[model samples]
Target: MTALHWKLVIDAADPHAQADFWARALGYTVEDNGAFIERLLAAGHAPAELTVEAHGRRAWRDLAAVRHPDDPYEEATGIGHGRRLLFQRVPEAKTAKNRLHIDVHAGPARDRAAEVARLESLGASVLRDVDEPGGRWTVMADPEGNEFCVQ
Candidate 1:
């Protein structure tokens, strides 16, 4: 059996902002698809309206992504082959709790509160702190209202 490669896709009102937030939060790098976009445009395979100038280069207007710094990626398309998160723009806003959420663990010897504070500074908000028998953790919401845990 072989393991499959996959990336988590998130729906957001602004994909670029979400990508920036997540990249900073996770210590990841934003994928730069400018070269591929330029090639597409030159080949007349894609319209210019689908792209916008971002980070001083071209990017998809409705999509953005972040990938772990250590992960392998394709140089041509700037697409990560492992540990990636893709954000796509949607017409509507988030209306309810997320069924699936990300859990951020404070690495060894790191302070959870400090991490939470750092995340807050990055536009995340603390929803609540939980001290359950199972474990203690902080629940937080991202800029787009996506819930995640900090432990």
Candidate 2:
């Protein structure tokens, strides 16, 4: 049997932009594929049209990804093999609510209000506040309207 690895794939209008936002929001680092991309291009294996200048380096035009700082990554490719979120460029804009969303646990040692405020400062907009018997959480949307919760 083969091992299976997975990453959360998101659709975005501007993949690099979304990657940047989520990277800061989650305290993750954007995967740098500059060396690998350059190798592919220079070797005539990949077309220049598939790449773009992002973060002052070459990146896939349709894809960008972020990963936890502590995770292991391929040194040659700068690709994280664990706990990664990949944003891929989509042709259409988001027109409906997300069927699945991310829930952020700010931790029992952390202040919920402070965490929510911090996320807002990073470009998340509060959709609403929810207070229930179970616990309290804030519904928020990212820059491109992807919804998530903060608790």
Question: Against the true structure, what is each candidate's TM-score?
Answer: 0.99, 0.95
In the range 1-151, model 1's lDDT, one tens digit per residue, is: 8999999999999999999999999999999999999999999999999999999999999999999999999999999999999999999999999999999999778999999999999999999999999999999999999999999
**Cα lDDT, model 2, residue 69:** 95
- Considering summed lDDT, which 10 consecutive residues are worst modelled in model 2? 99-108
User: Per-residue alpha-carbon lDDT of model 2 for 7-91, expressed as tens digits?
Assistant: 9999999999899999999999999999999999999999999999999999999999999999999999999989999999999
What is the lDDT of every predicted structure here? Answer: 0.97, 0.95
In model 2, how large is the Cα lDDT of residue 35? 97
The per-prediction tally of clashing pairs is 0, 0
* Top candidate, metric lDDT: 1
Error of 2 at 111 (Å): 1.0
